[model samples]
Target: MVLFLKRMLLASLLFLLAGCGQTAAPALPTKEKAMKVQIEINASVPNKQPTKLTLQRQDLVHKLYTTISALPVVTDPNRPCTMELGPRYTLIFTEADEKTLIEAEAQRYGCRPVIIQGERQQRDTNPEFWKLLDQVLREAAPPATVQKLALLHNGQTALIDSAQQAQALYDALIKLPPVPEGDPHQPEKQSAYQITFFTAHGTLSGTIDKQYARLEGNEQARGGSYYVNDAFMQQVQDISKSAHYAPGRPDALTVTVSGPEISMRSFIDTQSEDAPIMQQLYTKITRLPQKAASCSTEEEKRQKKLTTTSLHFTQWGLPLLSVEIYEGEHCQQVLPGPGSEVQPDDEFWNLLHKLNR
Candidate 1:
């Protein structure tokens, strides 16, 4: 009987160990999946200045939510001694969750917690918003209607006519979400590029940097400023460069240069089949500087007697390029004709001679 009892005890112990070692069942898929999350971080450190990071991947967002939710809440009546403005983070979630989850997470992380409330809470997931957005994009002009799409920025313009090129741009623009309400507290840098789509419908223009886009009419639309992430902006720029207009028979060419001493205008005929020199002139004039020198005072500028030159390159009646030159205070003007005293013999005059020939 003693041997049987010892054996029974040993068997029980083995069974318990086996049960302890067994793996837990996998968690069931969640019905409340996250559609998007915006994390705003405010840090005292200069390098960590307040910025917002947006995450859209459901799995990663879920993981983040789970990790944050597990942090223990701080219940200190007074501000926690550990808090000294190192960094404060605010998380905005789009899916359904207990309000306590955000509070607990904030307390655990020692950061301020905010839940996007009211209509803003459902901004991304609302079916109506999506429907309206879809309609706006659909009406944003078809690729066929686009005659030329141009990117105008930094006093330069690049034009293209490929339908595929226009479609890529339209695709990028359509992906932008409606701008949120209220002016963001963060300072906005000037737009890096202004894209103008010349379509049969009309001219559609937008000023966009990498992170933000302000469409012409969309600012007053129900949705405020179009928010575009960095990746999308990079893709747009890449497509723009790839679809740059290929030079062919230009319509016309104009070059204008003005300086303290002299102003000159040159027009070249690019429409003629035999006018190869017109293309060369077009290349030279467009390459000129776009802006005039910085003069501190009107009197000083007047004393400089700045000359202005304008050049027009044309094919038939249409002008291809119009060049305007404002001569710098230190620079001198050289005329192309005979008996003209050319002091500063630059490439400008060399190209002018080619055009004159």
Candidate 2:
């Protein structure tokens, strides 16, 4: 099943280049045209993971539109001119002739223009689909969800009441999936699920007898289960016994749950500071749902890369729902903070209360 999806994705990408609007060649203007635009990103932000490209664009205006459309931060694509990413962030457009369309797009997306030295020569373009995706991801954060979140007033930085809000906003921004390219007719297919849920208790450790059977944590305070693979369960037991840590109260426990149906799994032990158990759980949960072919050469080395699966949770944190994804590895944890808002339009206090608790 996983191999079938991989083959389908490859085939869809080829069809996208030949037929779809995503990678179609730019329509040549009736008259001769020459414009040059170059987009350079810092790429290296401290303590941040590398951003992946999602889609490509040839024309500046279309590129901007494509970028906005691909953004995962924007919950409502139709919402007019919502800028939730950052204040100092600049969208540099080095066009020879003033292109009102692209500039208008920048303004609409809450991005500003910075003049750079270069000829606005028209060339083949593949806009950074990943960075734009990060922008749309901020919708779930506090500064975005709060009653009167700080709007971008002029200049490079937007003011917020606390650093936590900024970090939360960044977190939401970065967690978006890459913009998919290929034939829209052929639906995207996901490989197996390899999800890991971590906490502070290492109480339950054993190999399960079957695949898709529930593996529950032992302690009452830290009990949860998901349909997982038999081989994955064995691997967890082996890793746990080999792992050696100074035995105090277990500060963090991680459970590795893998299969075709697992999503993001996590256990927040308010009791402990270090979450080694949770770390191991994350490692397993992210890996179990993947196939051998999906593991990249690098991931094969560490044996801990997870596929790009959806992160769905059970209401009130019970019986979490797991979804499959394309084969890739990422580290994303979504633990509701103290004062975490239950709904999208709740007070910021809900977030504070959850994270602090």
Candidate 3:
């Protein structure tokens, strides 16, 4: 009987060990999922300012929520902790409606608990909490400042080199709302100005017409034709008229597509169903930071059994700018035709591929 009891106890212990191995971490309790979160962060040291950010996108909020929810709860009532927290983050979460705002405070120091203030609960998930916060802040932060602004107006172009002016102009320009309905102040001859600015986000372009600059909602800026207040709009116009401005002209585009799935075709478009597409392609090509380079060894030997498209850009009587692209990642390049290799922004290459298809 003694032996049997001992065996029974051993089996029970084994079962409990297996169960413990499969146990998943419990998350902070919440009734509803959040689609957005607001975070405020600051350092414990002096002379620094706290920064506030609101993550409005759903995907980002969900990632942060997963980390927050997985935080292990602290059950010890009298846990010892260091006196001062090194870095602190106050996170406020309220997405789709619960009873009240849920706030969590994350601190760096001994016992490092992430406290959900309302529930009066603490979680021992500081390591992961800080790691995720670091990544999110880096991504959510915008470029420090605008360094250069390039404007294309009426076939004339100007490049603004003053960082201060570019920063001020772009900040103001991006905030203007779309022109309102039925207003009476129309300019006699309004010409559109195409402006491109360079930042950490890569090349971005927008258009300006008289007192309004039309900014398409792209990944960076909210899209709309924002009305540039008179004072600011006049400043841009005056800059365009300066001696630094240079004369230029728009180029015409011709696309020829020959592929297995499609017949030989060509477009000599300036103003038709294909005009906008051609114009956009031409504009993109002119700015591509492209040069000739060979493809990978494997790609070099791959059979060129795909469709080919060629674009020829012309300006009045100037020599034509010609390039050819294969339907697939062909050479992963746009060959400067008559020559075997050249580099074009893969983005531009992809755009043509979709259009040709």
Name the candidate that leads on lDDT: 3
Model 1 per-residue lDDT tens digits across residues 1-357: 999999999999877755543222223234255555555546556774455455555665665555433322222324433454544445565654532223111211233331222211111112332333233322332223445566654545566677667656665665677555454644255467667655554555666776677554321111125777877788777866665444434555665555554455554454554367666655655555433333333443578665555555433222244544334456544332222323333766666556434
Note the Cα lDDT for every prediction shown.
0.48, 0.30, 0.62
Backbone clashes in each candidate structure, one number apiece? 37, 53, 2
Model 2 error, position 258 (Å)? 29
Give candidate 1's whole-model lDDT.
0.48
For each candidate in turn, the TM-score is: 0.33, 0.19, 0.35
On TM-score, the candidate that comes out on top is 3
Q: Which runs of model 2 end up more than 4 angstroms from their true locations?
A: 1-92, 96-102, 105-182, 185-190, 193-357
RMSD of candidate 3 to the true fold? 17.3
Q: Estimate, for each residue in 1-357, the C-alpha lDDT of model 2 and write its tens digit.
A: 999999999999887664422232233322112232222223223664322122123353344444433332222223344455432222333334644223212221232322212313212212454344233222111121221112111111122344344234223322323223331433213212211222232222211223332213221121222234454545434433333322122223333344334444444553544244333333334333322231233442256454332323221122233332233334322222222211112233233223223
Residues 80-196, model 3: lDDT tens digits: 667866777787878576333468887776677777775555677655566666555544544335677777666566678877777777777756664643556673253466776
| TM-score of model 2 vs. true structure | 0.19
Q: In model 1, state the lDDT of residue 83.
A: 51
> What is the model-wide C-alpha lDDT for candidate 2?
0.30
